[model samples]
Target: MKAGKLAALGAALLIGAAPAWAEAPSAAPGAARIADTATDEARLMALFRDDARREDALDPLALIYRGTAPDPAALRRLFTDSQLRAQRGSVIQSLALLRRIDRRRLGAERQISYDVFLAAKREEAEWLRPDSIALTAVRPFNHFGGLHIEFPSLMAKDGAVKYEDSADYRTNLALIRAFPTVLDNAVARFRQGLASGVVESRLTTANMIAQIDALLAQSPEQSPFYSPVREFSAGIAASEQPALRAAYGAAIRDEVLPAYRRLRAFLNDEYLPAAREQVGIAAMKGGPGLYRRYAGRQTTLPVEPEVIHQLGLAEVARIQTGMDQVKRELGYGGTLKSFFDVIRTDPRYHPKTREELARGFAEAARQVDALVPQYFSRLPKTRLAIEPYPAYREKFEAGGSYNQGAPDGSRPGVFFYNTFDLPSRFLTGITTLYLHEGAPGHHFQISLAQEDASLPDFQRFGGNNAYVEGWALYAETLGYPMGFYKDPLQHWGTLDDEMLRAMRLVVDTGLHAKGWSREQAIDYMLANSGMGKSDATAEVERYIAWPGQALSYKIGALTIQRLRKKAETALGPRFDIRAFHDQVLGSGALPLPILEAKIDRWIAARKAG
Candidate 1:
């Protein structure tokens, strides 16, 4: 669900420049115990600020997202071997610096900041370890992930990259000119992957090959990288417009196109055929351990694959029961298997046109938007825009996804509803889908977090996937409290979406850990849920391409729900839904353990009061 192209890769939203001293004046942590208390405190904060700046400076994409111009060379580069080594060394140095900070002397909020900082640095250092860094930093892309998908998206007028002025055009043109270098870096990384015997699945490689083939089929004027040149604002001089356009167009033809052509040849002739046929990562060398690392990073929890698999199975059963009851209410006397077949074939449950699909999402958003004030005290200033995936990218996109808006609320957050192969899309899932991806789901959690200047930049722009995705998953249930889902079908939509998440737990672990085949995973989804074969196949492939990520949704939602129940049980009448929500949204995203601790303290504070 946390999908982005190149921009997504820059999601290392660090603890931004330390909270202003004037805002939260407190004694330096552990300062009293040290000979130079004040000096230690100043050193700690200065380190935090310096590290954040270093990362931003190195990341051209992050700077672009922050609405600032970066060195044009940033567009041409991602990671060189030397830069990667330097970055690793920096993380190691930062970790050492962090360890010297005294936690006991910090104020209440600063203590939380310290803990968050420690966990982030520790995680960074762990990933930087020779074994971990080599495995991950190489193979910088799957068929779905690499800059191949992102570069095109970012260059569009609507994307994160800006092109308002002549200088902006030149900056982008510089990036385009440097794209050959970017592709070379990717090829070098892929070669390292090939050498290490750490290649992606053939499925992933084949799809990547096809992506390049599709793009290469386009005309130079129509190239993804050439999109920005087509739209010239008044900021660009009329005489200079044609020249900039031709330059970018030729860059795509001479520079960008050939880079992908080489990539296509390498993948088609070498990598794909040499890649492992097995869908699971466990079959690769040192795969079992590597898979665990992925799982840990995605979930931020130490729970094993088997534990998640079992939890998924239980949740799947619970959701199935709900589905059966709803089926019974609808007076369908058939078994659940028959029900699945019925919905799949039933035209009424399928949208006839893409416009209808978009309209349905619009209505769902309107209903949720109207009821927003009743459920929470704070709402996002950023508006939510519903749109379909662009034609070129639609085939590969899942049913729908949400992208974060700009922090200042100028650009609206988008819920991209996939309209490809409309017959394969389900109408029953719309209400729940909107709740999960639109108004109260990603749009709220991400927008509110980014908009809040009170939180550090790291908390706003980056955090754990579980908290973000889990909050979205939990938002699906809010449809019930908001007085939607009254229709039996809409109620079933919620169950279907819940079942989708539950199935992910089983299928993700099953594919990666239990050695389940692609066919077997798709079949299981079809049997257990309302998914069409096409949708199920795409979802399974997503898990195969990106391992361990699928497990976060249900695991995260369940944790949040359990904590909410605990708070509700203890607070009774004192539990203000508004305040509890504000607290959760107020701090942005947190690791699960940190989130649990924060909630426990809140409960204790409420009890004391």
Candidate 2:
């Protein structure tokens, strides 16, 4: 879901490769160049804030998401090769500046910042490699997590962009007008992929083409892009609304829809024919190495695909035992596979209507909110809102996803649940899904960091998957102490959700690493858990479109669980669950190793006290 790109001459600074800049020069023992720990730390923090501002300047959408006003001029920047080079250069320079700080001289808090910033820059450096860019930048968008899908949602009335005043509407109109250029640049990138034999999978290509077709089928008035002008904010004069409406309608009709048609035509005519039949990145020119980098980046460790695949298989077997226990408690006489079938097809286990589904999640949130303080000491100030995926995007979306709100709490963080194919949606996963995507999961972790002004900008707003998603997955386990899974069916639901993550470990690796077909991945999912066919298909396709991301959930949960167990054992009677949680989340999302080290320090401090 996250995206970023560098040059061949700078290959020495690639991830895992040591760059010369990292070794801060040692001052002579007799020299007067003493380390100013406070001054250095202040300088470092200032640099972090400055660089974050620079990053926000380049990415107006980021500013919009962060609740900061954006410059209209920056909004027109297209997705071009020159832009990619500039981003890479900025990262390389930032990393150089970061390494100049003597990390050991700083206090513990800044040291954590120093390490996290350095690691993120290194990861960015690797991703920007010319070869990596060729494989990735060339395929700028896909069916899932692509800008084509995300932009519309972001521009919606209830979405991230502000709609308070005439200028706000004008800024949004500029964004809408600039979209065609972005889409055209994507076509250009796809052509580059085709010429270089780094094309996307045929399956994803078809899905993307279908998505574009769906957008083109709608009139400008019905389009999500035009929704903003349908009603102007109270701040806008009534007389001004007509001109804004006409401008929006004309932009969508003349520019946006035609651009979608051009993209769709190119995919149908040129790109689809040239797309790789194999879904895994391994089939492409530099796919294997790219997958390895993705695996490392997603997991935040240099773990091999086979190792992750084996871990997934072991987890699937273990979670199946839990599912069997739930089945026995339910007094089901059938085998686990049959039980899965029953859950999949039974109307009682599925939602009857979209409103019913919404109510289910709403009730789940209400229950979890009451119980949150018992487990977590600090909560997110930003309110959480539950909504269904817009009609345009639900088909390609996962069952649920979290979109963070403004750090200042202007916009409420949204947990979007897919209501497409309502009959196929399960009620059992509601509580578990809410726990992961809402409170004590993403909302808690993201909001807490951004709200704390004490941390550097990178630490507050930036994060890796293993920590962010891992924390959410681990949060799902808290349902036990909170007592929401008392029902036999709900217990099975949590296990099934856990099984989904476990299956991702298997299915993702199987698809990308072991030459498993899409059908094979979907079949593997169906045989293991109670996921419906349609949901299973979507999950498999998600992994295909974005490799190694699924692997993060289980891997991250395991790391956090292991650390908790270690803390419990070491501190014995002194162990405080709330305090342990505070320690885990207090520093924001970290690489797995950095997180472990942070926890170890906390345990040591507890023992000494």
Off by over 4 Å in 1: 1-45, 67-69
> Local error of candidate 2 at 266, Å?
0.9
* Model 1: worst 10 consecutive residues (lDDT sum): 1-10
Worst 10 residues of 2 by lDDT: 1-10
lDDT of each: 0.79, 0.83
- Colliding pairs, model 1: none
Question: What lDDT, from 0 to 1, does candidate 1 have?
Answer: 0.79
In lDDT terms, which candidate is top?
Answer: 2
lDDT of 1 by residue, 206-267 (tens): 88888888888889887777777777776888899889888887888888888888888888
Q: Write the per-residue lDDT of candidate 2 for residues 257-361, one digit (tens) a residue.
A: 898889999999999999999998788788888888888888887777987788788889999999999999888878999999999888999999998989999
